[model samples]
Target: MVVDTEPRMLKHQVVRKSLDSLLEGMSPGDPFPSERDLADAHDVSRETLRQAIRELLVAGRIERRGRTTVVAAPKVVLPLAIGSYTEAAREKGMSATRILVGWSTYSADAELAELLHIDTGAPVVQLERVFTTDDTRVGLETTRIPADRIPGLIETFDYRTSLYAELRTRGIIFGPVVDTIETVLPDAREAALLTVDTRTPMFLLNRTSYDDQGVPIEQRRSLYRGDRMTFTAVMGA
Candidate 1:
């Protein structure tokens, strides 16, 4: 059962907690307990149970898809500091899967060449993926790694748990990223995966990640759902 802190944050904390208990680790499309059964177990009215379920749906904790309320994997955090997506998700008790869309060795296009600080025709490894939580696609990412600096990285690192963690273990440190964030319309495929309409605005984040020597190592473009996700940051002088 996913018991996030402050169930009281929503109106029906008791009912929500009960439902969370029932849905934990259950597969998508599994039958949620009947309304009467849930009401009996939680000692609440059926209307209250329905209200709690709606809140869970909004929080992306449990989906009210076709047949049942499916438990969702935990959300990911995009820290202002450097962190790995897989590590962050695992820390919150969720599994992280990386799909290697594939790699390429090609001439850099104008904008990409500028972003990666590489000469045109430089070899690059392009990685693409959709990040999921409990089988629900939450974000889409495309990352480009400059090929010269890290040859054969894909052979070992493909589908690794956390790319940034592995890089650190290899004595590679990434400096702070310079990122630009905007909201834009999702394309057809993105809309389908994110379960939103194409017209619904999605967050577009373009980031250039560098190394200690001020050499760009990774260029990344990410799209997140505005409705289902939020990011947190901390800054201090």
Candidate 2:
């Protein structure tokens, strides 16, 4: 067994370990013991117990549900590769769906023109979608596609299905993608839409997908709940 001995043990660390052990006997959504009871049982001060609980909350091991603390569902692992969110959820034995929060078509401004490598004022379809896994809202995605490449996409596309799947049907296959991630906090509007507090941490991901000829096919920005999602990468030699 591996042991963490690098950092000298702190008072809160001791309590956190004990609480982690207690959680092994518990299941997701199970109510955690009251703070007072946990402090007494762990022989720690209330402040120390709260500190430990705070650590667990940040680590995604536990979460606040209404006014009670409960064991959090295991974070969904997203592969850092060219695949859709639907595939990732499916691998975790969960159902994936999305709600189209917004959709519009507009001329590609300078920023969009640079990202999509298109001329300024080119038509682009902008899609706003909220991704849900097992009934939990986990991510918000905004996708932009050059309208001229995929004719009639706005009229024929199904908002409920995977965007990648729809693109494949129209002969647009993603070859390689570049993804960047940043840690950020949500704004009031984002918080309300995600059903999370403004203080909740989020993973902001910007991705650009390209076709075989090195043409940018799609540009997407997605925000994922840090408490409910994790990323994994595969390295090759």
Candidate 3:
């Protein structure tokens, strides 16, 4: 008697293999075939195809642009260190450009006041900017600084230039910083600005930079595109 006991591959695995075959012929930013088409072509269930596509998205092999999925560019690796975004991109041989989106002085809210160690209602400068590499927008950075700490900052400082360099020239020095990283989805406005879908995942970094005396000088919230950027860190053993 002949027994047929060979284990068959899982449906999602088969779908993944088919998708790999499809990707072999595609270039970065090239739109992938529609989900229904892929499912039919692979002879797999729609759920299985979606699972495979989600895996690809998580692995950074593909990204969703509006309603279509496309091959993604290699992620730009950035070291988790204290430095300017411009300098970091330059180290990787990419031209970094900063565009100042807006700036205004406002009364610190409860949360902002606590983060900056200032009293609520104290004046704070809110600065928003976008960072791009090779003309591709990659990150959005919003910073809040105690207005009393940087006199004439709103009127005299060039918001389009390197803020850290400007602060250094003004005798403001950086000390230790506390940073936290999280994953988030872009809001509608952020999606429009980053040219990504609202559901696209991103890296949100919250950092508080301190002065030499350990006083908080600035609180920064930065959103980086997950498909376009990666963060690395080196630890001593």
lDDT of each: 0.71, 0.89, 0.87
RMSD of 2: 3.5
Clashing pairs in 2: none
**In candidate 2, what are the lDDT values of residues 1-237, reduced to their tens digit?**
989779789999989998889888999999888999988988889999999988888788998877888899888888878878877788879999888898899999999899999999999999998999888888999999999888887788888788898888878767888889999999998887888789889999999999988899989999998988898999899
Any idea what lDDT model 2 has? 0.89
Question: Could you estimate the TM-score for every candidate?
Answer: 0.66, 0.89, 0.84
Q: Residue 158 CA error for candidate 2 (Å)?
A: 1.9
Better of 1 and 3 by TM-score: 3
Candidate 3, residues 1-237, lDDT tens digits: the string is 978698788889778877888788889889888889988887878898899998788667887766877897777898887778878888889888888889988999899899899999999998999999878888999999999999988889876578899899989888989999999999999988888778778999999999899999899999998878899988789
Those runs of model 3 whose alpha carbons end farther than 4 Å from true positions after fitting are 1-10, 21-37, 64-69
Q: Which 10 consecutive residues of model 3 have the lowest summed lDDT?
A: 57-66
Give me the overall lDDT of model 1.
0.71
- Please tell me which model should have the higher TM-score, number 1 or number 2: 2
Q: Which whole-number lDDT from 0 to 100 does residue 11 have in model 2?
A: 97
How many angstroms is residue 16 displaced in model 2 relative to the true structure, after the best TM-score fit? 1.4
